[model samples]
Target: MTRDIRQAAAKANSPEYMSLWAGQGLRLANDQPAASTVKQTIDEASIFVQRFLTMRNS
Candidate 1:
């Protein structure tokens, strides 16, 4: 049970995984205008940082 819980938490926290997910999101959002591109990049980067911090904390 403890191992299962840990696995769940790790899945929730993995930065590399999250970055891929966010990158996909950015790609989808790319159809929007240029002004939105900066926001999307920043949002994706923020997700990357959050994932990094989560991994670091673990």
Candidate 2:
């Protein structure tokens, strides 16, 4: 479903992204995380989640 964005943004007004979202009115924000940071965060979260699940199931 295509809808209008009341506020203005670069991508919203850029002709390069005219084909973006296929007119779905959905915007993909640029969020490129650092590889090392992402990996470290994921590792930390995975360990916490594993421990929590194990404790809960005990």
Candidate 3:
């Protein structure tokens, strides 16, 4: 098992190889425009941080 893992990791190091990985959130946003997705994520993150910080202080 470790040998197989090492082989996979070695293949990933090749410059010609590339991985197009995306999280569930990114996959869900695929239909939206890129700019819109970015803005929405940032806005949501800002709101979450604000709420979390306020809660921590209370």
State the C-alpha lDDT per candidate: 0.71, 0.64, 0.74
Best of the candidates, lDDT: 3
Better of 1 and 3 by lDDT: 3
lDDT, candidate 1, equals 0.71
lDDT of 2 at 21: 53
Best-first order by TM-score = 3, 1, 2
What does candidate 1's lDDT look like per residue over 1-58, in tens digits? 3666656667889543232344455655436788788887899999999999999999
List the candidate 2 regions with Cα displacement exceeding 4 Å: 1-6, 10-33
lDDT of 2 by residue, 1-58 (tens): 2233323334477554233454543364246668976887899999999999999999
Give the Cα-based TM-score of candidate 2 against the true structure.
0.43
Clashing pairs in 1: none
Off by more than 4 A, model 3 = 1-17, 23-27
> What TM-score would every model get versus the actual structure?
0.45, 0.43, 0.55
Clashing pairs in 2: none
lDDT of 3 at 50: 100
lDDT ranking from best to worst?
A: 3, 1, 2
Best by TM-score: 3
